[model samples]
Target: MLRKVALGSGVIALIPTISAATPVQESSKEPLKPPLMRLSELPIYEAPHAEYGEYIKSKAKAEKNSYLRSVIHPQVQAVREIAEIGIAHTESLLHTVQDNYHELRDRTEWIVQYLREEDNKEIRYGAVAMGGLTGFIFGLRGGIIRRVFYAGIGTMAMGGICFPEETKEIAKRNGALAKQYINIAYNFLYGVKPGDPQLEVKFPELSLPKNVSELTQLTINHWRVKNRSIASEKCEVECFEDLLFITILC
Candidate 1:
């Protein structure tokens, strides 16, 4: 039987509440800025040392440990079983949530962008049609007024539909990632002041299945999916250190 010291969840403890690896919603009241190219438009950053170091090292080492347990030395596994399970669970959950959200968020943003462009085209055509129809029904003078009246309303309606309100609503209703991240953020908003994410070592009796080798493969699958799909091209933090830690947890 293996017993392991639980590694503290570096992320859930040190990061911000919003570190759930999800997107943040844009406030409708906020004026539109440059178009969002990626979810990084929200506040999220990568830890310089932590990103390449413990994060990856821990994961890779765990993978190595898993392999060793299955193929080479099931005996040593008795020493560090619980910690491995917790690490895999923690990393897999965060990375999977974040990577999955990133893909969906990017796709939604692009769809909104396309619909807005299409809306502009429709407005232009509607205006042109109104002018031509009015000319056919009334004299040139009446046609001009009618064109102005009807075309103005048509354009305004299209503007309303394609502009901030529609996009904002769509982003709101469909923004599952933002909601999820926000929930995570709330937990961290107050910070690790609450204490570290529960470490498994605190309860050595708690252990994962004896057949743990398969879990390693499952976690690797999650990591690969996250790497392939999720992207965070930008982030800004009001508190650099806090935010960096938060990003790790996220």
Candidate 2:
């Protein structure tokens, strides 16, 4: 009875200790975020040129006729030129990107040489069969034909080797991408139908720029809000002059 009681007491004590212990909790982990796109990787706005032109024309039309003739017209003309230059700059930038991605310089001439070589191999084989058969049939009479055929085939066969399809495909894709970038830039800089098709003549009153930076500044100025306080003040004075005169007299 004593031993059983002692063992029961020990078991009760052990149960209490086990029940008092804390449970282990797991720490929550945060999800990783997606990488942000670089400026070069971002897609440009569509029909930016058309939108820009419309914005300009709308502003111009809202102005008084004298202001439109004296200021807005020349400003529009200058902005157009600047925007066109900016488009050209964008094209060059895009071309550089494409070249870097494609490594065009490394593959261009080499791939052409390789393709020529593959073509030459086919030509050489064909020439051999044609020449052999012709010589066997007409003996010396087929000499001229055989020589001509052989010469043509030989020239082609002389090429280095066939260019790998992978390299050629990459080059082609790069070229296409470069062209697409240029087109996108064009849409952003010049509307679908620019008012002027030709820009050979420069307008000095517009303060046309000779460099890209100047052009960019001009472009920013083109879209910026104009201060027409002078025009507004003149109209306000003309409209309220009678009221002001009566008040002054009183």
Candidate 3:
């Protein structure tokens, strides 16, 4: 009985030791907590096929391009069209202004030339008629003062008609003087310097004589020279005769 009790106590001590060792073995066997791995140490999963990754990338690119075409391209094109239209409209407006400016310049030149022509006898006749009509209208007034004014105007009209050549000479001198005064005024008011090259003075053509008799002689001499040149060129005799007739008439 004594040996049996000693053996049982020894077995009881070994049971506690085994129980402590069991917990240690169980903790160690619990996968070692994956060796305390860091996030970078972890294995990354790859696609099963390499082409599959390329296909996914390509599809994403295609979808992006499609979105650009559908959503953004139309807006860009519309903006370009609007810009082109605005440019064209601006060009058209500029052209219209240029055309109008040219037309107005031409009309002004025509009016100036018409007023400057000394041979426009209609202007003198019209002036005389206007003066006569004004005088007649004022004469109808009852006062002696108005009668005197009307009589003076009638006498001036008669003098203008009777001495038209003298009147024209006086007018030419006055017009030239007035032109100088006008130019002076224009330069003073518009900040234009004297002797500016842009303000060119146009002299009358030397070839064209102002007097009718001198102009007729010049025309006859020109025709004679031209006929001689034409005769040297073997022109027809009938044509030469016709030209001589025209020259004589001129």
Candidate 4:
């Protein structure tokens, strides 16, 4: 009984020691929390002028956009349409001008060709008539002096008729000759010294027959040669003359 009472006393001593160790372990495991601050201790933030400025700018931009849509858009559209119309008109006008230019060029070419052909025909007719008339005039004359004068006249007429372009040059030369003669007369009559240079009369160089008989023979031979050449070539417009003859008969 005395030994059992001693064991009970020892168990009571271990309970206090376990209670002290539990408190020390609980303190070591838990962390300490920071103290809470009051609303008055918080940081004060000031509003920036830049944010207000940006708000004002955005509001103004919206108003400007609305005004432009209402007032300026229609006018811009009208101007754009007018510009397109003007461009179209200008392009059409350019096309018309180009077409007219081409047409004018074609007409001018045709007219020039027609005039040249008519001029050639007239020259040919004039040549034939002059040659015939000169031959006839020479045949009528009798004396040597008279015959020589007629021949000279006939030769001059024939040469001028044969080449109309040369005749224009001859006319210019004749005018110069007359001016020279007048200067000479002035020098003699009024005692004025001639200042102009002397210009000689330039005649057309031709392979003409010497006499009237030879001239007539040459004309006949020329016609025969021309007829032979025409006969040798393919007759492109021979029927035109016949048609004209038929029309005249009708």
Instruction: Please name the candidate that would achieve the greatest lDDT relative to the true structure.
Output: 3
Please, what is the TM-score per model?
A: 0.21, 0.17, 0.29, 0.29
- Screening candidate 1 with a backbone cut-off below 3 angstroms (N, C-alpha, C), the clashing residue pairs are 2-78, 3-78, 11-249, 15-246, 17-184, 17-185, 18-185
Predictions: Cα RMSD each = 45.2, 34.8, 28.4, 31.5
lDDT of 4 by residue, 174-199 (tens): 76787778757656766554564543
Model 4 misplaced stretches (Cα beyond 4 Å): 1-63, 117-250
Judged by lDDT against the true structure, how good is candidate 1?
0.59
Model 1, residue 229: what's the lDDT? Answer: 58
Error of 1 at 68 (Å): 25
| TM-score, predicted candidate 2 vs. hidden true structure | 0.17
lDDT of 4: 0.69
The lDDT of each candidate is: 0.59, 0.62, 0.70, 0.69
Say which prediction, candidate 1 or candidate 4, comes out ahead on TM-score: 4
Model 3 stretches astray by more than 4 angstroms? 1-56, 121-250
